[model samples]
Target: MSTVEVILQSCLSKPAGNSLLVEQYVSDTASGRRYLLGRNEHAAEIMQMIEVDGIIDDFATNGTTWNNKPVLTTEQLPDQSMVVNCAMCIAPVSAARRLQKHGAIEILSLAELCSHLPQRFKLPWFVSQTRDEIRNHLSAWNSLSTALVDKQSQQTLNDLLHFRLSGDYHYMSGYSVRPEEQYFEPFIEPSAAHVFVDGGGYDGDTTEQFCHRYPGYRQVYLFEPTPTNLANARRRLKHQRNITFIAQGLSDQQGSLPFDTEAGSASAVDPQSSQQIQVTTLDQAVSEPISFIKMDLEGWELQALQGARIHIQDDRPSLAIAVYHQAADFRRIFDYVTGLYPDYQVYLRHYTEGWSETIMYFIPANIKQN
Candidate 1:
C-alpha cells in the first residue's frame, strides 16, 4: 500500500491513547535523565504537562535557565538522556538526528509524545481530526492532486498528507527553508502596474518583500487587524509610496469579531478572546483593480476568500493563499478557487520542514503557464 494509504489505514484501525509514548519514555528513563529539545512556546507547554531535567537549545547560554529549567546545548546533553523534540517549526527527524549525533539515546517528536494526550494538547495541523478529514475527503484530495501544475507540487501534497496522518517528520525530509521566496514564485511575472493586497500583513515583512520585488508598483494595500502588528508594519513601511494600511481583519462579511492578540502572527478571530476587531470583505475594502492578493489569515483563509469572490471573478488577481492551517484546506481552498474561476492554474509549495507554510498559488489562465 502507498504511504498515505498505510497511514490512513493505521489511524482508522487503531484508537488514539493506546500507546502513551511520553509515559513509556518516563518509565524507561532514570531520574534527571529526561531533556526537551528546543525552548519555544511548544516546549513551555510540554514542560507544564510533564517533568524534564533541562531544555536543550543550541543558541541559549549553557548556564541559563528557560522556564526555570537548565538550558543546555546538544553538546552538553547527558549520556543516555531521553529527549522529546518540542520544535514544531523544524523537521523532527532532523532534530532527532542531531541529538543522536551528540550522543543522545532516544528522541520523540512533540506530536508523538502528545499523541496520547487530550485533544486540547494536540498541535495545530497535527490534530486528531486530520486523518478522518482526509479519509472522508479522499476523492477531493485526489482531484486536488490532479489539479496541481507540477510534479513537485503533487509530491509536496503527498508528503504533507503522509506526515500529517502519521506524525512522521521523515516525509518532510526533502523540504528546504525558503520562506522569503514564498509568495514571489518564478512563475509569477512582475509588472509595474501591479496593485498588491497584503492580507494578514503582520509586521509588513511580506509587504516589504513585495515592494522590493515590484518597486514601481502603482499601489499597495496592507490589512492587519492586530494593533501592535499594524503599528509595526506602518513603522517598517513608512517610507514606501502609494501604500494604504487598513487595520481590520479580512473575512467574508463586515462586522466585529473577538480576536486573540497575544498569539502574534497566529492570531485570528477567536470567540474566546474578549478583544474584538472589525472585519471587511476584500471586494468591499478595495475598489481599485487588484493584480495580486496574498493572504495568510491563520485558518480564516476560506472565509476571506468567500468575501473576495467578486474581486476574484472580476479582477482575476493572482492568488497566494495559505493552506496548511487546516487539513481540509488542502482540497477546500483549491476547490473554492477553481470553482470561481475554472481556468486558474494551481500550484503548491511548502516553506517549513514541518506542516506549516503550505501555500496554494492560483495563476489566472491569461498568464502563460510556465
Candidate 2:
C-alpha cells in the first residue's frame, strides 16, 4: 500500500490508549517529583490538569518562580525526575533530548499529556477539524503530495501528515531548523526594484528582514489591523525608506469585523470578540504593480487572496503565503492560486520543526525556478 493509504488506515482505526498510559504514569509518580520541561502559555493549564513539582526553563535564573512553583534550569533539575514538556513552539524531540541529558527519567509533551483533554489544547494545524478535512479531501491531499514542485516538499508533506495523524514527534526528526530564512527562498533572487507587501505585518519583523535582504527595494506596503501591532511595526520600520503602513486587515471584502487581541500573535478575526477592526481587500488597497507579497494572516489567507485576484492575474506577484493555518489549505490555497495563474511554479517550505509556519510559495513562470 502507498504511504498515504497506510496513514489513512492507521488513522481510521481507533487510537491506542496513550492517554491512559499518561494517567497511569501520573498516578504511579504521585509521590515522586514531576517537573515541566519548558514554560509557555499552556504551562499553567497543564499544571491545573496534573501535579507538577516545579518548572524548568533554560533561560530562567535562580530564585525565579512560575505559577508559584520554583523555576530551575535544566542543570538544576533533580536526577530521575519525571518531566512533562510544555514548550509547544520548540521541537518535541529536541526538548526531550535536552531533558534527558539533564537527567529526566521520563518525558511527555504537552500534546501527549492532554491528548485526550479538551480540544482547545490540541494546538493549530492538527486539531480535529484538520483531521476531518483531510479525511473528507483525501483526493486533494494525495494530489498535493504529487503537485509539489520538489522532492523535499513532498517529503515534508508526508512527514507532516504522519506527525499530525499520529501526534508523534519522531516524524519531525529529519526537519531542519531554519525559521530565519522563511519566506525568502534561496531560489528567489533579490532585486533592487522589488515592491513588497507584508500582509498581517506584526511588529515589522518580516519587513525588517526584507529591507536587509533587498536593500534597494522600491517600496513596502505593510497591512496590520491591530492598533498596538501597527504602532509597533511603524516604530520598528521608522528609519526604513519608501514604506507605507496600512492599519487595516486584509480580507475578501472591505468592512469591519470582530477581532480577538488577547492571543498575541495568534490574534485574528474572531466573531465572538467584542472589539472590531477595519479590513479591506488587496485589490482595493494597492493599485501599483507588486513584485512580491508575503502574507501570514492567522487564518484569513484564502479570503485575502480572493480579494487580490486582480493583482495576481495582472502582476503575477511572487507569493509566500502561510498554508499551515488550516489543513484544507494544503490543497485549497494551491488550487486557488494555480487556478488564477496556472503557470506559476509552486513550492512548499516549513520554518518550524513542528506543524506551524508552512509557507506555500507561488513564483511566476517569468522568475527563474531552481
User: Which candidate leads in lDDT?
Assistant: 1
lDDT of 2: 0.78
Instruction: Please list all clashing residue pairs in model 1, or write none if there are none.
Output: none
TM-score of each: 0.86, 0.86
Instruction: Please give the range of 10 consecutive residues that has the lowest summed lDDT in model 2.
Output: 116-125
Which stretches of model 2 miss by more than 4 angstroms?
A: 10-24, 38-50, 60-71, 109-127, 191-193, 367-370
Q: How much lDDT does each candidate structure score?
A: 0.81, 0.78
- Tell how far residue 179 is off in model 1, in angstroms: 1.9
- Output the lDDT of residue 53, model 1: 89
Question: lDDT, candidate 1, residue 328?
Answer: 83
Model 1 whole-model lDDT (C-alpha atoms)? 0.81
The total number of steric clashes, by the backbone 3 Å criterion, in model 2 comes to: 0
Against the true structure, candidate 2 reaches a TM-score of 0.86
User: How big is the RMSD of model 1?
Assistant: 3.9
